[model samples]
Target: MKRTTIIALMMLFGISFSKAQTSPTAEDKIHSFVSIKNPPTFPGGMAAFYKFLGENIKYPEQAKKENIQGTVFVSFVIEKDGSVSNVKTVRGLGAGTDQEAERVLGLSPNWVAGTLDGKPVRVKYNIPIKFANKTAK
Candidate 1:
């Protein structure tokens, strides 16, 4: 009886360990940005751009008070050389939301370069930023 119990526990442990090692699915990879080449260039790179947003972004106080929460989708092009350009809003909820999205993206730092056919290529990327009103809670 003791040997049987030990073998059962070992089998359970092996099964659980194998399950933990499985790879993530494609959907799990969507939210992250991975560059094929070195990091791309922007006027100020990501840090400077984020700083610009931090300085300029005004949280819609009214929206926050009302607990408005939504995701803003921003699309922009990254040049072949890795420079950020042509930023625009693909989706927005308003309440000064679109402008806010544009402002944040425009101020984004350069991204790591992308590649096509193993060569550097310009690509358009889209990102969604979520805003939640903590005050409402």
Candidate 2:
């Protein structure tokens, strides 16, 4: 009986150990691109991307009224699944331009995820959003 109980316990322990080894945790799944072979891309290209931005960005009324014009810098992570996340302003222009920049970026479609050694990985990208007030001098 003692020997049988010991064997059963050993089997249970072995199974649990095997399960732990096979299952990866969230920490192990982080696939950020510190060094990458290729950069991420939009669906069409850079020109199309800029065009999309131009078409989508609506000049904030407050900004237009105040004649605020400058560049807003934004940073975000393009995940391995081609989804954008962690969007933030690295540098911001006031008069509602900063919030507008964040809004426009949040509306952006997923980009082609970056590649590290041919494997898809999350990459951090920074971009400057230009705010030009055509009506203002």
**Which lDDT value does model 1 have at 3?**
100
Give one digit per residue, the lDDT tens place, for model 1 in 1-137.
99999999999999999888886653223121354444344456666654666566667766666666788788777766566677888987677767877876766566656654565566666777666665565
The TM-scores of all predictions, comma-separated, are: 0.54, 0.74
Model 1 spans with C-alpha error above 4 angstroms: 1-58
Candidate No. with top TM-score? 2
Cα lDDT tens digits, model 2, 1-137, are 99999999999999999999999764235443455668788889878878888999999999999988999998878878888788899999889998888888788898987776677777787889999999896
lDDT of 2 at 136: 91
Native-referenced Cα lDDT, model 1 = 0.66
- The Cα RMSD of model 2 versus the native structure comes to 6.9
